[model samples]
Target: MRRWASVVAALALALPGPAAAQDPIAVPSPILTIDQDRLFEETRLGQHSTREIDAAAEALTDENRRIEEDLRAEEISLTERRGSMSAEEFAGLADAFDAKVQAIRAEQDAKARALASRQEEARQAFFVEVAEILSEIVREEGAVVILDRRDVFLSADRIDITDQAIARINAAGRQTPAAPAPATPAPDPVPDPVPPPADQ
Candidate 1:
């Protein structure tokens, strides 16, 4: 074994460097590249999440449109009545309407923000599960480094693991749990009232 090792070592050294050998004894970088965007687009969980987000956005838009139309009609009606009302009464009504519109806008904005937060949380939870799948694949492949395809200009097709990851993720489970809701902290228990000292 030692003699064979020596012969092999001599042969490798004799074969000029990369410039000459071309690849008589080349060692690959063992870097894995993945198309993350493709993975997300193709994965079942990702697709479902996207659909949910789109539906939520559409619902909000429709609700907003309805509110806007109602407000518009009210504005037109108020304009028609302006001439008949006392100035103070008209001013009060206008102020109230403005406040109501502002409140509606604020409420819609909050709902939109909440939906966005939920979608983001759901995705965050998904990636956590995906990371495990990726780690397992990486180890199996003997990869020293894993890279997102977006950062790479080019890579051998053999190094692409996006499809494998998607498969493994799907096989692991079809039911991707939604991100857990934020916990509401329990109110502090009221301190028991000290027993009233016996009247002396």
Candidate 2:
């Protein structure tokens, strides 16, 4: 019985055993460094961000100019009114004008806050897309590890995959169109004119 058991074991071992595991079943995973700054600079997100900022700046400038003109006009009107009015009347008018000025400033502040929030949200989305691209590259290359090029002090050009990564990222980005900006609401339409009263 022991000899029969030995023969069975030998047969099992001789049955070709998964072709001997060709190359030790170990994947060669090398660290990949990417120049993220360069990638970002060349990306669509970067271009979009730059344009958004520039437009915002121009809008702010125009707002400022409008406010300045309004203030100047108010000041000139107040000067003329003050010269002709009694002290009590002048004081009341000045208070009303001051309130209007404060309201304008508040509106400006709210607009600024909204702009900042939108910009932050867009920036976060941009980074998330970049990270996804990096992950995809790591998987495709069979890389077990990846390091940011900025963090490393020395790396051979072969290990640097920034150009390849950027190409892939751009290709991926081109696949999806960016969401369209929200449309401005239309102004309310004027009501139809009421019929004139009949002659009394």
Which candidate leads the pack in lDDT? 1
**Per-prediction RMSD in angstroms?**
15.1, 16.3
Residues 137-166 of candidate 1 have per-residue lDDT tens digits of 888887788898889854555677988998
* Candidate 2, residue 23: how far the Cα is off, in Å: 26
| Stretches of candidate 2 exceeding 4 Å from the true structure | 1-39, 140-164, 173-200
Q: What Cα-based lDDT does every candidate model obtain?
A: 0.74, 0.66
The number of the candidate with the highest TM-score is 1
lDDT score of model 1?
0.74
Q: Candidate 1 — which residues are off by over 4 angstroms?
A: 1-28, 153-158, 180-200
Q: For residues 55-95, could you state the per-residue lDDT of candidate 2 as single tens digits?
A: 87579879879988978886797888677766766776677
